[model samples]
Target: MKADRIVSVIFILIALVFWSQTFGLQYNCSIFPHLILIFLILSSAIMFAQTFFAKDIKREHLSGKDLKYIIISIAIVFVWIYMLDFLGFIVSSVICLSILTLILDQKRPMPVRTLSSVAIYTLMVLVFWFIFHKFLLVPLPTGYLI
Candidate 1:
């Protein structure tokens, strides 16, 4: 099997296991995860099947630098989740989103670019905060200090 086929098959297995695990959740909580997992399973099956028919198709691969940056971004998101309760949603999200935006932009005039990205994401986070807390009636984490 080609590398792409192997990866697709692995992900299909993973999605099956993940979808199955959602069955243990309460009915209300399980519904969203079920939808997402089913989507993943279907997409993976399509990819795996395409691998056999699309041998002539060119496959795109990420450069080592891009792969490294992608891995680092994933780590940052996991860390952001772990720290959310301790640092609070607003503060931790600001930091993480700012960093992610800057990483993706990487333009000239370093200070200006950094500041613009930070400002934009901060505003975005604030809008989400208002929507979730005010309209949706969901309470967000407020850290000990904040």
Candidate 2:
């Protein structure tokens, strides 16, 4: 499909740009990003190839509800990035995660569900905090409260 080809080309270009940028970074900083970029490029290329070779496609379309959910999820990530410097990583991450969880599982009661979501996300954040700070020796962003 035209859309698939376009997306594949765009991803290839983006991967190339990122690959070029990685060359300017220090070895330690560039290694992981380079690895991920290479993986992305290879996967995109393989997918594009498969698109050409595929016998048939179901041509399933995204529902309006699904599209809205995608937009909301993307918006949450952008807002989380913007809030990171001001609110710090832990707080922003937990808040973003809780919100996404609530959005994803809206069938449950709001009050009880919200609290459970927050608790789950808080535990997740703590685990990440420990891994990043202690094991990886990477510093986490800390706001006034933390």
Candidate 3:
């Protein structure tokens, strides 16, 4: 199968799984996920259909280094998720976002740039936390350091 088709199928499956889980949530909590899942499924289905009609698609092989980075990125995300309960959403998000940004940037890291990135991530995380925890009245994972 083509890569696009495979990705679409995978996303469709993921959407279905999440869709099922959403039923257990209260109506207010489930609404956003339902909308997002619907978008995911529709976009993936559209991509799958386009893959069938499109010809001469170029396939690029991932290099070993690129594959290594991808694997590491996935591992980092898993670790971030695991850390959330212990570190809280804000701390975990800032740490993970900074690490991910550093990993993806190929240029030599400067002290100023690193600090700026950390500050930016911190601000972003705080904004999101405020929106969800304060404005939306949604409870986020809280731990010792929050």
Candidate 4:
């Protein structure tokens, strides 16, 4: 089994675990998390099967630049998760999205990136505030913002 196949299989198994936890425990499926988990499980299984049965397993190579990007992305995600508790959804999300957009945009102008980041973050804030807060009745972390 190639590394790719092994990883895909592992992810598929993990997704199954998540699905079981979501449904078996009777958690809130009103948010569609379980549906997303099912999709992940099915997609991972399909990918695993494809990789396992491929005649010519193209060796997936990770270059130094690719590794750097992966590391940075992971670091950003870590900071985003940690900051969410301290800074709440709005502030932390805006900073995270802005940094992510700046990092991901290769040739886009700074003004465009800035505008895009702000727009995305604003939409996220509205969605969280309206849908999650008002409709779903999910309590957001209050980090001195409100």
Which prediction has the highest lDDT against the true structure?
A: 3
| Candidate 3 C-alpha lDDT tens digits along 10-42 | 999999999999888999999999999999999
* Per-residue alpha-carbon lDDT of candidate 4 for residues 42-125, written as tens digits (9 for 90 to 100): 887787788757786456789998888779988998998888788887778778878877886677657876897689788887
Q: Rank the candidates by TM-score, best first.
A: 3, 2, 4, 1
The TM-score values for the models, in the order shown, are 0.66, 0.70, 0.72, 0.68
| Cα lDDT for residue 75, candidate 3 | 94
Model 2: per-residue Cα lDDT over 13-117, one tens digit each: 999998988877898999899889989899889878987887666777999999999999999999988887888878999999988887877587578868977
User: Candidate 3, which segments miss by more than 4 Å at Cα?
Assistant: 1-34
Runs of candidate 1 exceeding 4 Å displacement: 22-27, 56-87, 110-112, 134-139, 144-146
- Can you write out model 1's per-residue Cα lDDT over 18-107, one digit (the tens) per residue? 887887789999988888888888898888888778756675789998998999899989988987889888889999988777676656
Worst 10 residues of 4 by lDDT: 22-31
Tell me the deviation in Å of residue 129 in model 2.
1.6
lDDT of 4 at 133: 78
Worst 10 residues of 3 by lDDT: 51-60
Candidate closer to the true structure by TM-score (higher is better), 3 or 4 = 3
